[model samples]
Each structure stands twice: as structure tokens, then as C-alpha cells.
Target: MSDFTDASTEPDANVSGATPAPEATPEAGTALDIVVLAGGISHERDVSLRSGRKVVDALAEAGHNVTLRDPDATLLPYLAEHRPDVLFPALHGSSGEDGSLLDLLAGLDVPHVGSAGAAARRAWSKPVASSLVRDAGIAVPASIVLSHESFRELGAPSVLRVVQRALVGDLVVKPASGGSAQGVTIVASPDDLPRAMVDAFTYADVAVVEQRIFGTEVAVTVVDSGDGPQALPPVEIVPTDGVYSFQARYNAGETTFFAPARLDAEVSSAVAEAAVLAHRTLGLSDLSRVDFIIDSEGRPWFLEANVVPGLTETSLVPLAIEASDRSVPEVYDALVRNAARRG
Candidate 1:
């Protein structure tokens, strides 16, 4: 666990543990030369770039010296020459989520935001993360993992029959890895299964077909400024087309969101508890967003955890941070300041 402490929960309060330099913001002890890493060779490249830009703006506004950098050959060499105090990796999809880049940062001894490489790999794989969370007493939908090679070599018809028999319900088909809902398909009809599998394979070599429970879809963002991970107020997602696709996620006005989730206090608290438990169970660090489907019975079923959640204007994490009575710049500033001290 990180040695950093929770700096400040108030919207405009100063950081408690650190004594700031006169010119620095009240959040950090000193002005940090922070790098916001964004824009990678991933399906969500555009989204990643947007997220990075937003983060850079927030950090700068909070009085930290921040720069946005893309992943390139020169990135490593540049970091070696002028190592920034902290790296807020604002990357999404395989290029960022798969843990390769994070592992590289650790090898360079650069303090960064989010989970370690190994833990990231576990959370990035939908099947692996679901299994681990389920083992930890969280309820997850029934699911199966199939690879492109297996679907082809072993025959798609037979495989589909087996999967359909085992998981009988409205299904959500998606890539095992990747983010921004790039290649997800909701298969409510039996005839849609084959096509959905094909769509999922376009985004990844493996596809995860899971039972889709009908419920209120929500995102609970878990952030650890210094204290252990705490769940922010849940954001209830209601897509006009009834599916939270890539377009609905990034496009403004495509979806309606409710902060605090309009849930009963008991349900809300339970959801928060489940989110925090999932964060710790997955060994996530810094921050994470746990997606869930709250069934009619008010049970929150685990969907997946995003270690590097989007920070775009329409993103749920920003909405949650705002609803929690905290400003994004203040919270992010404290996180960056704490990460720098951990190094």
C-alpha cells in the first residue's frame, strides 16, 4: 500500500500533511513538474488524448506545472533526462491498460498514478477480474471466455451452442480487454449471439460473453487520496438507445446521468461498500471505477474495474468527484502531490 495520506476532502481546503512552498498551491508542499501521459496506439486513442488534456488543465489550474505527453520512442529517453516528479497516466485501452507502459514506468523508478503492472493486468482482463471479485464474495454475472483461434479451429457453431446452453439470458458480449465500450454488443436475441461474437472479436483476440442482468446501470468511482480507497457517489447511467456504446460514452447528450444514483440510502451504501471491496480485492492503487448492474433486488453485481478511467467532460469519474462535494482540480492536485511524495 502507498504511504501517502488523504490530503483533503473539502472542496477548497488545503492539504493537511504537507507544508506548501509559498508560491505552490495549498495542496502540495512544492510545485511539481508533472507529466500527464496520454494518446497511445490504441482503439481509444482519441478518447485518451481528450482525457490527458483535461487532466493537464486541472493540474495546471491547481498550481502544478503540468505537461501533456504522448507515448513515443522519445518518451523514455526524455523521462530519463528530466524525470518529472509524478506521472498521471491518462491512457485507456490495451495500449495503456495492458500494463506494458506501467511496467516500463516502474522499471524507470518513476512514480505514477493507478495500479501496478501486474495488478493492472488482472483488472484489465474482464474474465480474470470477474473471477477474482466473485471469489471475494461479490456477485458477478455468469460468463465465458473464448478466443478467436478457438472459435475458428474448434468450429463456431458447436462453441456457440455450448455457450448459449450454459449462460441463458440476455447477454452482453465484449472484448476481454480494451475500454470506452469500443466493441460491446448487447445480445438479447438468440440469433444475435453469432454476430455479437464477431463484433467482439474485432476489438480483441478474446471475447467475454456474460449473462446480462436487467437493473439500474451505475458507475462507482473509488479513489484513494491517502486513506484506503473510498467510493464516490454512484453515477446512474441511462442511455437513450438503451445501450451505453462508445458513441454514448464520449458524445455529449447521448446519455443522461444522475449523480448520487437516486438509490435508497441503504442500497447506495451497499453499492459503495461493494465498490471499495472490489478495489482492494483487485489490488488496485491510486484510483479505480467499478461498474455495476444493480438488480431489482438491489444487489450490485460486479461488471469490471477501470484503473485508468476516462476524465473527459462526459466521464462518470468527474461527475462522481463533483457530486462528492469536491472539485476535480483539488482532488487531482492532492493525488498528484501525494504520488510525488510516495516516490
Candidate 2:
């Protein structure tokens, strides 16, 4: 068990014209037994471990009995015997976000903090999620989803020709179902497209080649303690190297973040509204982070939605929480109590 310590930091003030969510009612000062699962065999295993540690520390500071555990073969048997009051999964990548583990937890009648299995499935696949959000009136970038097998059978030359014709601009290629920018590449030149596809395929069987939307990149975190889900302040991402790669995300000084973003009042409100709409449209619960790109015209384009967003020291969610004038412990505490009540 990791020692519990206060991890709250003073972030920049909330974005102008952004209304913070109302403080959730506490759970009568009752400390409950909580198990935080982390460290899966996914490519994001290290990130998941870091996020899990952060969660464990915050929950412990909130007066809960927290235990940190890895998701291994013995996990299910351990849960069956111990049955903590609530399970808080800080896992990332496919192990946690792909809905397989969530479904198993549901089968065991475990009350975990996150979206349900069905909702997680909808948000895991980039193509499916983009389509669903687009149907709900959100603007998603035009892209093509290709399977590795299809890319080989159809011949790379033919596929690249069609892709270039369809998306006539700088393109961004990434794995169809993963996060933390593990296998993402920006293709400005046509010669880079084939290599980008191979990089994306290294992470997942399917790859998404999308039109690179040039603008400010921001991430909005939505939290549902007990009341309906509400959007937190948006966190603008500015990487020193120009690309928010895996290093920029977890490294301490590789990127600079502007909490609540630097957009105007009207645009800020619109971004928050769009985030909430995307959350509702995807049927997500507990907590989620929706990413977007704000064009020069002030239009918010949906990039992706994360059901289990990172909570590490340098993660955007923590930055948004502090920017909203709320502590990480407070937010995590409410989620645990809410999950227990639902159970």
C-alpha cells in the first residue's frame, strides 16, 4: 500500500464564463474499503500504474481504506473473497477501456467507478465513437478506417492512392482503438503515409487516417457524482515539440497546459456544452474526458472520448479539477460513494 498524501496543486483560475459544477454532497464522513486496480499487460501499463497510484493517494487522503492491486489472474478470485465496498479501476488502454474487464466485473456484481460495459464498448473504437458523436450533431474529422489485412490484400499502393484522394490535406494516422498517443503520426507529406500506417498497425489491427484539424487542442473532463454529468473546465494542450506524443503526456516538462483553455467566453461555453453532449450521447457515466480541436471559426471538432482518463500528476483531469477550485480527493471521494450507493 502506498502512503496517502495530499496531491492537490493550485492550478490557474477557471476559464472565463465557465461555470464550475456544484460541489457534490459528501457521504456522511463514512470511510469505506476501496480497491484500486492498475498495471495491466497493455502498452499503457506504466501509465496505468502511475494513474492508479495517484488515485490511491487521493482516495486515501479522502479517508478511505484504499488498496492498490494489479489486474492479474488472481484478481477475480481475490475480489470474490474480499469484496471491497467499491472498486476503482485506474486502468488504461484496452485492458481497462475495451469493456472486457468491465463486463467481467459486472458479471461478478462488482460496483466499479466508470462507464458500464456497453457504453465503454461504444467509446473504445474511434470510428464507432466518431460516428455516434457525429450523429448527435458534433463535428468529427473525416477519416478512413482500414484493417491491416485489408491494407495488405488490397495492395498498399492502391489504398494510399484512394486515401490521398479522399483526404486532401495533412493527415493524422493512429490506432483505431487505443489511447495516450501510443501509435499516432502526423503525415504532412504523401511519402510519410505508408510509414504512418505501419506505425498505427503496430498498436492495433485497425488504423484511422484522419484529416489533421489545425487549431488549439483541448481536453474536457465530465464528472457525474450523483447528479447528471457535467463538464469540467477544458485543459488546452501545448506540447513543446508540437506533437502531444506519449512522452509529452507523461513527462513533467515536455508540455505546457492551460487550464480552462484560452478561448473566449462564448467559445469556452460552447466547448463545455459540446463535451456534455458527447458524454450523454455516448451513454457514459462516472467520469470521462472528451478531446477536441477548436478551429479558427470557433467550432469544436470532436476528436475522441476517454472513459478512463489518466489521473497521474501531469494528467489533464487533475489540472481541470484544480482549475475548477476542487481538490482531487473530493472528486474521487464522491465517485466512490456514488458507486457504493449504486451497488
Candidate 3:
């Protein structure tokens, strides 16, 4: 049992005696202590900063004692000293999404508004995440992992032979660990494989080459708030360039988003359920967004799980929530409510 009862569930900190270690007293009425993480050594640092700003503003408006902090060297010391009740980690990619920071949070014994350390680490690597999810009974497209160092030392001829033996036609090659589509390429022919490999290697040591699935691309947001986990409505992605690349994700006018996606009720429900299942199976906590590909047979195939997914202006979760008639502030509040309970 935790020393502090989750704030959302406990009637009050005074009643439960489960408030965080800091000297946090309610001002006039009820006040929650919130620490939102914005910056990290990630390629998506700017986006994470924006996400932290939005989350901090919303939580502050919701009458919480909010603290916004970047994961600078001072972060651990600040956390140790302040002991805020809840931490909202809004970081993206690399150090933010990897398990290391989450592990540090575990050491602090603080409740964060995101996935657990193990799950985040697993999902940070594309190939590993895909394999783990698929083995857990989720359908996934065939994929392969290639090492750039090995390719360089052993040469491309042998690597090419191995990849051809392992995968089939039309592949998506991307950095194994990074996100926001950094250094990702779609190779339709053998001639493009070398260039794609080099491009992917620029971002990460390992690259993932996945067989393309013919279907709709969608993302489902899942939140676990002690009531157990549940999935939000699905968001269908249609990119103008026929790929949901970095530009499509960030550039304002490059893609069209459809919420509750144009799928049958049964299929939609199945996808949502599958997402929740994946979240639980990975042992992630609080929240995560599961990406998928709906095949020609109308079956959903798991692509990857984002433990600390993007939460920017053009992010998908807010849109999906709005499609369900939930406002952004309301959604943010729900996370706070859940974080309180998580304590």
C-alpha cells in the first residue's frame, strides 16, 4: 500500500493522511499538487514543452497547485525536495519515453500520469514493442530489426540477403527507438533499402523494417484510473502524402483526422477493447495511446504502444476525446483526478 492514498479517491488529504511528503495545505478550499514535466533530452523537446504548458495551464485552471519542471539535472533534486502529489510526464521520444526516467520516478515513489518503467522501455523500441505485442496475441505486421553498426562492419550485401530472407515486399523502415517519424522511410524496392537503412541509422543504432499492411491507420487512446483501464474512441489517420510522416503529424494541413473512425460498430468496439488489453498486457499505468492498422479483412493489427504519447496542439488524443463530447480541460482534469487516486 502507498503511504499517500490517491488524491482523487481519498475524500481529502486531511482525512486520509495520504498527502505527498511536501508541506501542501489546501488554500481556502481544495488544492492538488501537480508537477508537469516538459523538457528532456529528446528530439521532440519543443513539442514536449508545449504539452507541458497546456497540461500545466489546464490543471492550474482546475484549481490544482501546479509545478512545471523540465527534466534537467535539477529535476530529481527538485522532486526529492518538493514531493508533489502527482507528476504529469508530458515528454516525447528518447529519454522521455525510455524507461530510465520512469525508473527514477519509481525510486522517488511518486505517482506519475503515464506508463510504468518496464512498459515504456519496451514500447520505446519499435521492433521489440511489435514483437512483444504480437506474441501477446495482438495481430501485427511482419517486421525485422537491422543493426547499422553490423551492416557497416559486415557490409550491405549480407545484410540485404538476411533482410530479403526475413521480410517480403514493400516495407516501412524507421529508427527503432525514436518517435515522431524521425528518419523513417518506405522502401518499395531493393534499390531504396540501402538509402532507407542509412537514413534510419542516423537516428538510432537499430532500424525496423516492417511489411506494410493494406488498411486504415488509426490511433486509440487508453486511460487507467483505478476503475481499471478503458479505451477512448479511435482516430483514423489519412495523410495527403499517403503516409503519416513527421510533417503529416506536425504540419497543420497535411492530414485529415476522423474520430470514431468510419468503421462498423463491432469493429470499432473490438479495436478499442484490443487497445485496452494491450495497455494492460504491457503493464503500463495511468495512460497510453495504441496505434494500429486495420487490414483488408477488417481486422485490427497492433503497430506500437506509446507509453508517453505526444500531447501537442495537433495531437490525436484531444481530438478523439472531443469526438466523444469531452472537452480538453475535462480530459486533463480526469487525468488529475486519476493521478490523485494513483497516489
Write down the lDDT of every candidate, Cα atoms only: 0.86, 0.89, 0.79
What local lDDT score does residue 181 receive in model 3, on the 0 to 100 scale? 83
Better of 1 and 3 by TM-score: 1
Write one digit per residue (lDDT tens) for candidate 1, span 1-343.
0011223222211111222223564544567888888887898888887788778778877777777787887789989998989999998997788899999999999999889999899999999999999999999999999999999999999999999999998999999998888889999898999999999999999999999999999999999988879999999999879999998887777788999798999999999999999999989998899999999999999999999999887788988998999999888987887787789
lDDT of 2: 0.89
Residue-by-residue lDDT tens digits, candidate 3, 159-268: 88788778888888889888888898988988998899989999989888888787999999987666788798899998888999988886676788888788899889
List model 2 lDDT by residue over 88-192, tens digit each: 998899889999999999999989999999999999999999999999999999999999999999999999999999999999999999999999999999999
Candidate 2 vs candidate 3, TM-score winner? 2
Worst 10 residues of 3 by lDDT: 1-10
The C-alpha local distance difference test score for the whole of candidate 1 amounts to 0.86
User: lDDT-based ranking, best first?
Assistant: 2, 1, 3
Question: Candidate 3 — what's its lDDT?
Answer: 0.79
Residue 208, candidate 3: C-alpha displacement in angstroms: 1.0
